[model samples]
Target: MQVSRTATKEDFNHLRIDDIKQPISESRFDALLEKLQINNLSEDEKDFFQSIVEDRMVTEEEFSTLTYEQTKKIKQFTSRSDLEGNYIADSSIGFEKLSMAPLLSAQNISDDEEYNEAIFNTFKKLNLSQDDGISMLNELGGYINQEEKIIFEDSLTDEQYDSGIRYKTYIGLDMKELVSKRLEELNQGLLETSDEDVKSDYKNMIYVYREIETQYNNIQDKNRVENEAQLEQYTRNTKPNPLYNADVVELYNNITHEYEEKEKKEFDELMDKLDISNLNNREKELFRTILEDKEISNIEMDKLSYEEMKKINQFIFKKDEKGEIIDDTLIRTNSRINALLRTTELTDDETFNQVLFNTVKSMNDIYEINNFLNPILNLISEKFTAFDEVNSINFITEDMNKVLDELIKTFDEHYQETEYDEIKEHYLSVINKYQDLKEQYNKTTIDS
Candidate 1:
């Protein structure tokens, strides 16, 4: 069997899946599972599976054992039938945010201890020596308390089903904002921040972010209804045809999901290959923003368009670790905060602002199903720009001009009678600016 992306080094040494073909059915999967020798399952593992069968609550260790099995089963994403079959009788047993965590926890963090010992394991994860982790927490740890740590960890989880949308709706974003602020403050505190305890907290924040993204899937599967509804409302307004509005909205929702899936797939594949430990805070923030993009709820997506890419940029930059929007009003003093960073990312305050602007800018165009611009104006040219038939980007730029012409014509023809300045002016501004930016980009290409 090919090693599953989620497989462990331990599994790598003991197991080989060179022969487990895709589309393996239950019988086939059963035999494969048996061959792995469940009899060898640790005492904890045996109790876990039996509990799962009994529909009793097994401990976290049990959850981890089964996760290993589910992952092996889930690698069959290409085969829907095979994937579907895994969940036929016992629905909750499948891989999704629902299944992966227990397995990850068991594999990564052992469960010999229940509460305090378990929370203490966070020390190892934060990359602090176990001693340092225990010591720092041991020092001021009285402040958080054992029970408080448990609650904090539990609350931070972006788990499915149990994770209320309100978690992302407000909680997650707020946490992100808070963490970002903490990081920013730490950046300022350069000297003051170096207390070993502070460093430990910084590492802990990263762990929290990772687990949230890993399990929550960016709140994607969670927000289908609300997004579709808003799209329906938008559709109703645009067509002025109440009769077909339901159909129109449903169709539009499907398109929105599909477009989102495409970008998400690309982004996911990209991240699975990265060595995350090497990346810095800025890089991680960018990547997290990208991953978390697809996981958002429909309502958020609906509200996101007005901001353009700038919205994404601001959302991330202004965000704390938990993912909340920062106050733009903070800018007057935040400029000083930005200055303290020694990285290549936030070149200046303007560039910092641009990152936020760009994040939301490309969002809608690439993800909207009926996005007229990309479908019509979109161009694909050979990557060999030096010897290509026509420079690809240049070709795309030219195609964009044609698309722009169509935009102007559409506005002129449709709004000719309406004296709605706001509606007319808004679209006209969009067209003019889009064209100017594209042309300027191409001009730079030409000059180069």
Candidate 2:
């Protein structure tokens, strides 16, 4: 008879069971048990080892006890290099098996405490420390609670089927009542807490609860007819067609005709009240030309010729008490030029010239030229000439003409440089023509 021998650490490194070509003899089995140091083996362990030698099949229960070193030895014995070849020796699989075994077995442990104890012990066996084991158990409890919530939601009755509303009619718990209770609790908390942060947190919680409660109640009391109408709008099969309905088509045509007739009547009344008969021939023609359009835009007003604009300006701004045309455009332009003149530095001749040029070009009519531009030109001429204020400044003096001629020359020079080149050219022509006209008028008066 072969007696069993105790396994040495070096013996395990040389172990190779897969190389065995035949079933282990009784002596070899005894020797294998001795190498594994299983003298006090239980019946289950004995049967497990016996099956490995007799039938060459490893059981999960037998394999579960294997460490990484034991797995490596098994791989060597099985002519496999990968330790993972032993499925039951994998830590992940072992964790799953260990974790699930207690759960499956606890199907009979109806007591919650007992079941928890079983889970705790299973997790403990998984080599987790006490704190880690408790934390994992807490996480599992949270997951289970979430699953229970889902199940509860799915099991809601028709009366409690409002989505996102946490009210449970089946449990006779009204979310509004819960909100009221929470509000009372929050008020109490606010009174009890001296800490501002804690009070703020309680207030915020109350706000959230109140919002949820209000929304839930509002949804519960929603008008069924309106809801049904909205739902019908979303899901209705038939669409309205105004053209297909004779009454609707007739109503639309009648309304459109009525609107057109009303607009025409109003326009004709406005045209009838417009009396351009007193206007001069040129003004009448220009007014008629503008009347050709059913409407006049500000852009069209800006595009009017200088002569045409003059007639409109004279009619619009009739003579005031001082026998001067009260043209707001010229007044505003003069005010703006005066403001610029007041702000301008005397030595900044470039800026002064540019302002003068722009102001002259902005005049849209003869009225603006006389009232707005002439005054600005006079100011510029005065600025250029060395005149003693006590002496009256003659309008057609050599000094004024010299200043005017220099300004005209400057305008011509800036014509190509300015964006308003056409307007600048027009200004130069106006100044030259004005000087010529003034000289002729003065000579005529002298001759008479």
Candidate 3:
């Protein structure tokens, strides 16, 4: 008898159609009938209530005139009832009823007989349940379209659109068919057109459509998977590694492949400046083979002199003031000092000695030799001198002595042969520095 003022038709309509005609058990019928008889109701209302219990059925007509509160009470009582009998049973219909019953009956939403038949028949062929079609209809913008086709609301957000697509795909809708069709059309267009610009446009469109088809296929494949293991395998095999994908790699290559004629001219000029004509046949061949895409191997590179290597380094690894390598050319007429003052273990003495000897012996300039040797010299002076006499003697014999002896001999040889005053001065300076370090080492040892 009580009605809620706030209840609207929209709220009432939100209940599914099948829920309106719910059934009641014998015990529930007895209890509800007793309660209804005691309530203050008109004779007609009392009879309506009694008939619902006696028949063990709640119908649409019986529910229509009831207040929202009365309707809610009936809904609760029916839902909790242990339903009996074949009242409005699915067995009466052709197919099994869905758990989520249709919000609106199909006949109520679709008035056009031809359109309804066509759509429902298609749903049947696709193996989609009647509930699936009805649920889609409830969510669609317009259930009765003149075009006899389904369409989503224009105001649907991206999330809603994607959700709709997923539902449609799950229900066996051909989500990718349009995209696949477009790709076939583009393939034909590509073959028909000889114009490069038109061909490019067609190719781009084909790529886009193919990607769309692949995405839909991914969704379909995921949904069709029977178990976790199959899904895991499918995901692992299909997921793209951007670094290794041929299309992605080719795209990046094309972006960075902008080699200009000006760069080639500059390289040629640099080779000419370095007197490539004076290089021996092997050296010339090695130098010529090093290009933007090609690099000289470590074995082949070991054949070059220290001065030649220095020149090549200046050209190849030219760094800006910020130490970032740039495309600008670097022309070095002489090698500059580049000392690496790092700790060296006595255990690695033999390898270090060989590398140092090879590097120094190949140096044609005093600056290059001094620059390379100064770091090693400083390490021994600071680190080795601190060692006790016994340790120092052992370390010197194992590591320091071989490289130091070779370096001193090379410096002496360079000093005697060089005609340049600058080279001679640097050679003396380095030799003197080594002597001072050695004297310190000896003093430290003698006192110890």
Against the true structure, whose lDDT is highest? 3
The lDDT for every candidate, in the order shown, is 0.33, 0.39, 0.41
Q: Output candidate 2 Cα RMSD.
A: 38.9
| Backbone clashes (count) for model 2 | 0
Cand. 2 Cα-lDDT: 0.39
Which residue window of length 10 is worst by lDDT in model 3? 164-173
Model 2 lDDT-worst window of ten: 87-96
**lDDT for each residue of candidate 1 in 223-337, tens digit (9 for 90 to 100):** 3345786664433211232322343334434543554465456444443432123444555455344324222222222233222322233322333334443332122112211
Candidate 3: where are CA atoms >4 Å away?
Answer: 1-239, 242-251, 254-265, 272-448
Task: Give a tens-digit lDDT track for model 2, residues 1-448.
Answer: 1111112223334545445445655556555555433355555644544555354545545555653223323322221112212211111111223333322222112112222233333442454443333333332231122222233333444343332212111122222444477578777876875444345546655554454444434433353345675664423222232122443334334543554465456434433443333456555555544432222323334345433543343333234445564332122122322322322222234333333433444544545545435543456546644432312122332333345466556656666466785777766676565465346434544565
**TM-score for each candidate, following the candidate numbering:** 0.28, 0.18, 0.20
